[model samples]
Target: QSIMMGGLIKKGSNNVESKIPLLGDIPGVGWLFKYGKKSNAKTELLVMITPYVIESDDVLAQYIKKFQEKTQGLRQGLGVKGSTAALSGKTDKPVPPGE
Candidate 1:
């Protein structure tokens, strides 16, 4: 059995504004000569964890083999290059050079 947990945290933001010195003080038409700018920043953090128990090495090996078999043709018919080699069920190790 496996358990998955996830969490997300968000932080609030700050807003700022600015304008021309004297011209900005006037009301109504004064807006024409004033430039205002506001900036808001937000931060978020996400965490996810999965926990599982395996009794022994044999059990782990069995899981790995099963995964390999299940995904044997995962890349088939995707128009990928060298697909024949991918279907060879050689997921556990890299092929040595010079054959």
Candidate 2:
């Protein structure tokens, strides 16, 4: 069995302002001659996964055996006990080159 984990974090901020020459600096009228905006944002993400390794042919064979055993009942129920080629539109024998 193997384990993997990952994470990411991001944070940012931005400020924007626009104004006319001298009218933007005026006392009360400054609001009409200038526009300003500020913003802040943060984001985070995390991920984890675990997997099993079949290191040898023996191990691989064992997994295959288990899968076949588990699916045998389903196959029997579906009446599909023989080769799957017919269902998949394939032929058991190879075809010759261009007729």
Candidate 3:
């Protein structure tokens, strides 16, 4: 299990794109694989990344469900593994640029 730098975005924009070293070098889904030399032994890595923390429980729950619904039965993986989400609460204010 590992937690490394993954995605970053601003405000309530559901569409935030980023380019990371090595990751952006690959094409399509191939971008998921960032390294070589996967040993023949058993290994596991469960990444935990909180994309953006918001202030609305309803939105948070909605996004969490979206993540859960998408990652179902994705078994093929390499040295890379991960999932992402936005955590929000009711009291937070939305940024003007993201509006």
Give per-model TM-scores: 0.35, 0.39, 0.26
Model 3, residue 75: distance off in Å is: 6.0
User: Between the candidate structures 1 and 2, which one is better when assessed by lDDT?
Assistant: 2
Task: Give the per-residue lDDT of model 2 (tens digit) for 1-99.
Answer: 535488899999999999998999999988899989999999988776656677997776676666656666677788765432332234677544421
What ordering of candidates by lDDT runs from best to worst?
2, 1, 3
Question: Distance from true position, residue 8, model 1, in Å?
Answer: 2.8
Q: What TM-score does candidate 1 get on C-alpha atoms?
A: 0.35
Point to the candidate with the largest TM-score: 2
lDDT of 3 by residue, 1-99 (tens): 345655543333233335567766777864564434322333344446656766897776887777655553342233324333222233354434312
The lDDT leader among the candidates is: 2
Output the better candidate (2/3) by lDDT: 2
Off by over 4 Å in 2: 1-8, 52-99
Instruction: TM-score winner between 1 and 2, please give it.
Output: 2
Candidate 1: tens digits of C-alpha lDDT, residues 1-99: 334465566666555556677877788877877666656666655565555578997776776676555555563444333323323455576645422
lDDT of 2 at 80: 60
By TM-score, the candidates rank as: 2, 1, 3
